[model samples]
Target: MGASDTPPFLHDAIWQERIFNGDWIAADGGSHAIVEPATGELLGRCGAANAADVARAAGAARAAQRAWAATDYKQRAQVFRKAAALLEQHQEALATWIARETGGIMPKAQVELREALAHLHEAAAMLTQPKGQLLASQEDQFSIARRVPHGVVGVISPFNFPLILSIRSIAPALAVGNAVVHKPDLQTPISGGVIIARLFEEAGLPKGVLQVLPGGAEAGEALCANPDIAMVSFTGSTAIGRRVAEVAGRTLKKVSLELGGKNSLVVLDDADPDIAAANVAWGAYLHQGQICMAAGRILLQRGIAEAVTSRLLEKAGRLPVGDPMSGTVALGPLINVRQVQRLHAIVTDSVAAGATLLAGGSHEGQFYRPTVLTDVRPGMRCFEEELFGPVASITVFDTDEEAIALASATEGCLALGVISPSVTRALRIVNRVPCGHAHVNDQTVLAEAHAPFGGSGSSGNGGRHGGPADWDEFSQWQWLTIKSEAPQYPF
Candidate 1:
């Protein structure tokens, strides 16, 4: 059979259910069902942890940190290596579970799983790198700095990339000898949280070093505010992340927050509309546009706005929207009914604000048709808000300056994509956009595991996964100084 012939429900499996410590017993309380967004079919049920549960998980993590930290760096690297190997060995099953539970198609789900494993492998290799640096001096004295792991980290993960993002945060924190208390987004608890737990166990990690407390926002808040937690690493909305930062700051704990974005894709006059259409359509509609880096707004040169908009609409209309387990289905449902309502509100508010919908402002079940809007202004919700759905809004720009101004107007700027034939123009726009990640020839959603990734402004205040920098995030630098000859009698 061809790739399109792959069956639905291909990756469903019984998740291993257990408590790594007594704290986990309290953490695993209420239950919630994981549903395939494409078909509204139940994938599995996961525990919906409460504030008490988060506290328990935090206690477990705190209890485990000293032992994990005291282990040799090489030993920790070995555990990461073993986890990477196990993940590779079970790639098929993991990918399948992701596709079924998160409503990610087989190809996309497989890519994320592979990327997650590859990144973990890179983390394993990076663990061997020497920490800090030695400063050269005229005398025989030596001065150096070394990095040490924090005690315990609380990880709050999002749903769009339940496996990779969650593991991306947890692995680096754990590899650096910091135990982690993870609270996964409710929409993908089983797929991300449970699968990762299985890998950690298989790698022979000591019990209580990594705990998964699956639940909603309250659980995350509880985890973030715990005084026993040494740090909080969160990936979600900007407002919530700010609250987390506040709590962490009040308690004098460290924090890293990767928040929301109203990212943009700018197509210049000289660019190819066909290519631009393809990239924008995929960027806006993939995973139903639930990605944090989704191109929420598109700025087109007036010369090509109408044509590019037309082509983009046609491409989006042709995309398959059905059961996510179906290999041929390109578009899936929103994560839940609440997300559906949010998308509706964005569209409704945009229309009420005088923007016109060119296509699709409707929904049935959790499946929303790809929507496009025109005549959008700077203040409209569709143009300003982080509508985490397959919705795109367009406004024509006369010059590069105008495009840059419009793109930078939002408080949140994570990633920017500029399509221009001239390298100089691309570089110019890249410099103008106030974002952490910039793509010259492609869409904003494009990312590599080894590349540095984060956001500026409201997008992210803390950094996690991304190339060599990930190691820096997980470890703290401490300066070490020693004199070779007692400073030659204090001369």
Candidate 2:
């Protein structure tokens, strides 16, 4: 595949150009070729933005912020509703782009589209909700504290779960009347940037309200450091997220960081091994375990450790891996070969450190086999690191205290899950782990448009983005007062 062979959905001027100031324009850094992760073939070309390009985007967003903020709230909401409808009309085509570009199976791609649509609908609903609360004043006057837009919000999304992550922030920011300057990951730009720009454009969003610039670190840093941007929403690795916060903090911009996670799935002795294995497989291997909420650590109580390990091994061996576009397979290629090397190193190091590799510990090209390891101790590389791949490490624990300690050991505490026959037992374990999201008798991988989602510690800052949380993440508050007449002052 090459630029000439680009899919019809992406074969347009908009797909190759940067979107800002209501039109597609050339970037200062020329163009970069997008490669299909599964085949290593050229997918197409996308405009690459530099610092200058990011500055231009910031200026455009700032210029349009006031008018968009002044627009009627209901009308602003209609734009999102229209965008959601348009997404439904083009869901199949968009999903195909996601599958091909991200090396995700068709089912996973459909889920991303569904969640993205849900985000849009939820954002539309947010616009119609109450904006402020009235308060009683000590004097004969009325006072209120109301939410207001942050002017221009910079959105930086990652490649994994590109569509959902991007829209989760973009839709809400726009709904609350803030202009956006977006920078989608360079690896998967079309599905994340061009598609969003096109949807909003067709949905009657005014020019300059939403700017999409697909770029690398240079552009991302520029967007964060720009003086005009009042806030930044970032989703990526914790290392990069910290850098974003540092840069944006210099200017005192509100920053929302949704970073990495070393999530765990705790299997209690009272749980059925078969049921636990199913959830573990799904949570640990979905989309090749590329999700931030993936179950990287599987902590098993000693009593049921052997049973669950056996079932997990069977599940791992049966999962099919191949090119997603050519055939039906449960697991597809990772984002690139670099990721495969990193994951394989972690598995190899763990095995060397005495962790038993019960099942697959290898890969062919970008397609890594679903791997299972047992006898993994806390100090092993696999247990300590964030294995963002289709690899699960099992650590046996003798008691509930041990389980909680092992599950909460990782610095990144984004998602945690507990499986037990008794809901009370599961709740006890769930409450002990400090994570942004938790599931009882379920898997770790989960997200909803109407749920508050984020993390603490190394995972992210305390900021969250979803449902009512969106009001705080994307906007600020303003206090107002009214009186029938001027009152006497202290002076």
- Which candidate ranks first by lDDT, i.e. highest? 2
> After TM-score superposition, what is the CA distance of residue 216 in candidate 1 from its true location, in Å?
2.5
Q: In model 2, what are the clashing residue pairs, if there are any?
A: none
Task: Write model 1 residue lDDT over 263-362, tens digit each, in one string.
Answer: 9999999999999888888788888898999999988999999889999889767777877776777887787898999899989989999999988889
RMSD of 1: 3.8
Q: After superposing candidate 2 on the true structure, give the runs of residues whose Cα lies further than 4 Å from its correct spot.
A: 1-10
What are the per-residue Cα lDDT tens digits for candidate 2 across 1-491?
43454434455655665544568888887888889998888877888999998898899889998999899888898999998998898787778789999999999999999999999999989988998999889677899999999999999999989999999999999999899999999999988888888889888999999999999999999999999999999999999999999999999999999999789999999999999999999989999999999999999999998998888899998999999997668999999888999999999999999999989998999999999988899889999888899998899999999999998897878999999989998898888889999999889898999999998788989989898999989888999999999888999
**TM-score against native, each model:** 0.92, 0.97
Off-target runs (Cα >4 Å) in candidate 1 are 1-28, 137-140, 462-464, 483-491
Question: Residue-pair clashes per candidate, as listed?
Answer: 0, 0
Query: How does each model score on lDDT?
Result: 0.81, 0.90
lDDT score, residue 463, model 2? 89
Q: Which candidate achieves the best TM-score against the true structure?
A: 2
